[model samples]
Target: MSPQPQAAVGAPLSRVDGRLKVTGQAHYAADHAPEGVVHAVIVDSGVGRGRITGIDTRAALAQPGVLTVISHLNAPKLPYLDNPGGYFNPQGQKLRAFQDDQVHFRGQPVAVVVATTLEVAQHAANLVKVDYDTQQGSTDMTDAPSFELMNYARGDAEAALSSAPVHSDRSYTAARTHHNAMELHAAVAQWNGNQLTIWDKTQWVLGAVAELATVFGITPESVRVLSPFVGGAFGNSLRVWPHTVIAALAAKMTNRPVKLVLTRKQLYTNVGYRPRYEHRVRLGSDRRGRLTAMAHELKAETSRYETYAEAILDLGQMLYATPNVSQSYQSVALDVNTPTPMRGPGYSSAAYAVESALDELAHELGIDPIELRLRNEPQEDPAHNLPFSTRRLRDALRTGAREFGWHRRNPKPRSTRDGDWLIGTGMAVGCYPTHRQPAQARVRLDADGTALVQSATSDMGPGTYTSMTQVAADALGLTMRQVTFQLGDSAMPPAPPQGGSITMASVGSAVQAGCDTLRQQAIKLAVDDERSPLYGADPDKVVVRAGRLSVQGDPGRGETYRRLLTRNKRTNLEVLGGWSPPSGADRFSMYAYSAIFAEVAVDARLGLVRVRRMLGVYDTGRIISPKLADSQALGGMVGGIGMALLEHGEFDNRDGRLVNANLADYLVPVNADIPEIRAIYIDGEDREADPLGVKGLGEVVLVGVAPAIANAVFHATGRRVRDLPITAEALL
Candidate 1:
């Protein structure tokens, strides 16, 4: 077994790549300038749903510096093969780029103009005229045709609601939101014979390799995707999108290295966004706020050609102690790009409804909000009848409350006023299901006492590079600077996709295992060697610290790794470690939880709300790096503020077109909008969750944030808004 980490894992360390980034030495996807590189600009479909009638590319081809124009009308046929299993979509055909005349969604790539320069390509793309047979399509989640993909029931929820002493029926709607990552979606494709190398912006390099291989009818090994750095992903980069396919296709047709970049408008549709959601929650509780039942009817938007589902209703069934619980999850077809997972996915949308509804019930019963929640806290997962790996929800609540001065909050709405502002405090529970996946890593130790660890994972702004390095440094008994961590390459060790907060728990475990293997190898060699100072020492009693092997309590009698390896004629020591989550029906329900408290000031006459202070206490498993975890927590809260007050992806119902496709129109919280914020984590680990004993943290941080703000707004105004982005229009 590997010894506990001491020097690095738990320490507050800066990112190893921070200097490279600050010095402008980091190369992103678009920064790669391949030899003989050309540019390809995509022509997007203007209609929401249509059939391509005719495409005119002659004008584009005649433009100066225009290399070629490829469209469905003149493009070569691709394999357009179906994925073996769930490489991309488990069900239904994926969107094939420039492979057919049918336009399935708005902003779908219609044509590509390759040119010697980006300006020429842009001008050529504008010149390529496309005619479409427009069709009326559905984009509304509430009224679209729905298919029930999931249904569950434990008892009679309707009867419980009918007989309960207090009941609240409410509906909450969240507008569609886009993942506005700082780095634009881009791909630089280069091919030598059959070997393809791509520098792309993506969350999963292997996923991109697989999808690109399937599209070109090539082996996965022939495609290599590299993404060493990502500005941000949220969740939009989890899968390969159509523009990457177009870049490859254009590169092949033009017989040159091609760089393709999506415009800001194109990103809204080329990649996926958080689907619009309509969640109807009905809750029944006794007069004391103890639960009776809950029924969650969820409707979410998906492309007409694909099915997208999430855990929107799961929290309703398990978040509270309810005897009778039922859930129905429905997918509504829309004439839009396939919906992708955003920051919190379904959990964020569901918590907004469930937690806010609970607040409404509290107001109806004239009970304290926190007291009402405590009255129904479950001893175990009520829906699954299983013990939890670890649940520190009550402690998180109390800690957050005490720190935020919740006990001093004036319970009466509008009672605490600061001149023109009405002060209120509110809190809600946040959670994300604990997730783990199979992963592998390679650790190599050089004779120079430095270590290198590689895994095919992503950082995506959650400080993955920094966190993984910390784990490897401690596991290998080296200082932070002595170890280098590398990731975001398909050729590296296989890892699970970098979404759902799985990288730290999965890849981190694989890294720890790899380092442990290397450490054990060194220890065995040192003890077995006659020249070693600690010869014939008990392998178990020998500990390697700072690359020096010493017997416990006898550091004086030890040998340096440099001496051992030099005497042993070894240049490098390398080991591979793999981590596959245990197989079996889970007997313990696993999740990370948080109790977030917020204080908001609402302008009395103007109806504008501003967050005064926010604090979150988390039941997350042992935090890997306090600094990175703080960044994650703070970023999540900021995103939640956007979801609650400013962000909304409006659509024109008549044309099924996104109204606020650009960032200028879509408002996000600026520095002025955010006030004092803080985070706390309960100290401990979930041994059952993974080898690293960490439950996922990134997603859970965003859950329930919108509802917490909305609930606080209610406390200030004594009015409830069922929809998201509690705007001044709704508040007034």
Candidate 2:
């Protein structure tokens, strides 16, 4: 076994690209200013659901520098691509901007106005007129049609509820939320004869290439997609949205390179969002505070063209040891755009409801919330009946409680007050299962002793570039400056989507494999060369340190890699490393756990709630880069604060249009909103989980935070607010 180096792996090192980012040199997708680029502005339908009766582009075409206006009337037909197994949805009316006359929702692209300048394109887009045959559309989930329940069950929930000594039931609602990444979505498309190149803001560049290939009826090899820097992407960039396709089509139609950047209003209608959700939870507990039964019912909004469902009850069955658990989830189809996965996705929504309900149960039974959680910790995953790779929920809870001074918390609500504010502290446990995916990478060793690694994963602001480089550096016995990590090009080795908190576990393993292979080759060369000092050393007994090969017992009698390569007249060496999980590994239980603590202050008069401090203790195994891991932990906590008090996407129920489409109307946490946040990782490793023994940490940090804040509110005001964004209005 290789000994873990304490210096590089766990040390707090700043981002390797910090200089590039601060100097305005980091090139994002939109920063690629290609030559001969023309501006394209999409004209959207004003009506929610309608058919185009007439389009008058005569006035728009007469303007100077106005090249063409492509509408459904003049747009060419495209192949209606098939979506396999819900992985990618390419059909379903296909947003064919300038290809179809029917409008399913408001802000549906109807025409493209091409001009020499962006202002001309904007002016021409307004000049193009269209008449619509409008019809009524449903936008409100409360009023939309409901379907039969989708059910999951283990034991008899009703019977267990009937026999329980105590029970409580409550309903909670979460408003829709937009991703609201700082950089808006933009696409630059250029077409040459039979090939197309696109620079777009997307999480999955390969998925975008495949979608564009099918839409254009061309080979996948003919398309190249590049996105190096992303301002932020909760989950909005996971898939290729309609606007990207529209821009590619517009470029082909005009025979000119086209650039399309969505306005803030356009972002609301075009990009993906978290759908509104309503949950009803019923909990039954014994007098001693052990949960006996749980039943959850959930309903969320989806688009009429696509059915979307968030597994909001997934946590209830797995997080606890309840035997009688039952859940039903359904979606109501409305005339709205499809919703995609957001940060924490199903888990966050489920945690808010389940954790809040548990708090209520604790209050009813006169039990501390932490004590109640500790009482129900399970040895195995109850839902899957498989043993966990590693579970530290109890340890996390205990450590967090001690560090948070949880024992000092008053059991009675409104009992602790500080002058004009009600001060309270609360805690909750967070869990996110590990998702495994196969990945590949290429490692190259130059004659100068420097190394280069290539993969197809995007950084998306989690320091994927720096962390992967660090792993390669340690594996290859080289310093950080000697290794260069390359990614964000589809032409590189394939990889899984960067979401799901699985990037490090998947991509880092590939990097390690590649560097390990390169090191082994260097060792073999040293052992085989007659001129080398380590010529007679056993290859198996050899190890690399500081770019040198030597026998395990003698570090002084070693040959440098550069000297060996120069003696052999070798310019460079290369290898490809691939990793896929072994069979039956998926059958076993797996997950990462976290304990979160939050301190909050509530105004007794105005009903205002403010978080004063936060702490998260995580059990993510084998953090590759300590500084980057801490940043991820703190950033996730801030996002949770936004989910709890600021972020909400509002839509006009009358016309099925997003009402709060712009940032000014929609709310998100600013720098002033975040409090003093801190994080601690329980140092450990799970060799059974992966080669690197790392479970993902990106998504789980946001899971339990909202519930902790809501529980703190209950501790402060003696009020149980079930809804999200627990505003002053709700408390009053």
Candidate 3:
């Protein structure tokens, strides 16, 4: 049997790094101040699709403190390496910043102005001018030309749909959304001989190292990436974008350390975004609400150079017990930058469509939404025909419903009213596929009883540092103050990207393994030494607690690890622990599930929708830190509210440019927009999943929220809004 997870694994503790974060001692990429480091500002193209016709940098060079204005006209052509695995780039566009005059999208970096000061660089960048030969570009997913459709089919969906007793066909649209993290993307590049040292804001340091090495024609080992602290990522920093490469190129060209910070405007155009999606779903069910057939067709926008596809229909095939299921996903190539995965990516879009359709069907059949969902629950994954590793979705739904007082909800639209507001409640199921990756961690125990754990994974404001420290402390039998967790450096033990909610499961296991090894080593030393009280005791009978080794059933006979190390004349003991997924673990159904309930009050006269309360019950295997997990779940729900009622990236189809590029125009949920939120985790385990028994809670928490709120809005006003950002205009 696996050993128990000690200390804070299930404890409701605050973030271990909370003090450092609040005190402003955490070091972010832009916070570093290296000696002789210059500043750089990118000059972006104004035209959406164009080729440069002229360049004039005389005025930019004439400015004081200006070093050089580098553009495609003078920049050297570098090697464009082949695509490496795991970095999701559909375009396969090799790192080619400032390599050509051709522009594929608006705000594409045209040139970079370097100067002694950030102010000088900014001023010089505006002084540079360029002429463009513009061409009409399409940004609208509906208007853009599409390619061959990708299809998945199980049985005869058309026949089943036509023969079913009840059927519903609906269309839904999800608008483009930006990451909009609090910290803007920045990169600091320095070259010592042929080796490159970069302090960059990124989700995957190994991916960044490979990308930079390939771009500069250098070995991967020659590049060092550091991002010890990140304000927030939300999948924006998952890849090293062109801006990072441009900074490195600029630094190498001028032979000086350079810092480049992307402006908020540049963030929308350069970094990846959640692509807009249009889905048409047809559902067929019997009078008993058993799903008979499901057909889903999806179209989304991608860059002209890339064919990006979001698995918007993957869940429909497995979520219910539908025998006839057919899905087709297609993409329209547009003159825009390639889109990447956002939080919940395809699953969020899928949930919005499928859950909203279910709500509609429930209303049509005069059936309770929860009852309808329960009637169609599958014992196994219908698509894969495999038993689940561990599925507690029914428990989650029941618990959430009871907590939300769902039995008292009035199903009839506009039937429940309070004063001038129409009140209603709704719920939806959330699911995210569980993913695992191999990871490594190192633990060093010093003679003074202090321990340090190191990994390449990053925190990104999710309390990764704190959680790992807790895991290390518990495994090593040390206090929290005795352990320090270090991450966000490529030099540390390698780890997978911190996104996908896999960091804690992968890295925490490694920390556990490392600490266990350290403890066992100390035990072996204590039992073998003739001078120790446990000299004759069997190593297996010795247990370490509070950094002290003692024989089993004898608490009084123990020696401190510090004393043991001092007697051995050793300064410290170090161990490296590696963790990979259990063999054959992927052969079964694996996913994290959540049931979300929302209460809403819609102003009938003003056509305004306001959320009043939200409750989320999750079946994430084990709670690592109850307080941190609660925060993650609540934060995800807030983000979902924004996706449902406020957030949308408006694009000007005439030029394919994002119209609301800045914060003032683009909307996100503020503190005033959030409602009272609560989170509950089903106390459970999936021992086969991992040593930590943890499934990701981050992405799944937000998956069902938008649809739940949308369903509630319909219940409040008798309005079925299929599109996202269900605004007052939609109600009106």
TM values, all candidates? 0.98, 0.97, 0.98
Q: Which residue runs of candidate 3 sit more than 4 Å off their true CA positions?
A: 1-5, 82-87, 583-585
Q: lDDT per model, in order?
A: 0.87, 0.84, 0.87
Better of 1 and 2 by TM-score: 1
Clashes of 3: 0
| Weakest 10 consecutive residues of candidate 1 by summed lDDT | 82-91
Candidate 2 ranges with C-alpha deviation above 4 Å = 1-7, 87-96
lDDT of 2 by residue, 431-464 (tens): 8878778999999998888899999888888898
Question: TM-score for model 2?
Answer: 0.97
Give lDDT tens digits, candidate 3, residues 119-173.
9999999999999999887777777678754789999999999999999999999
Write out the backbone clash pairs for model 2. none
lDDT of 1: 0.87
Candidate 1 Cα errors over 4 Å, as ranges: 1-5, 83-90
Clashing pairs in 3: none
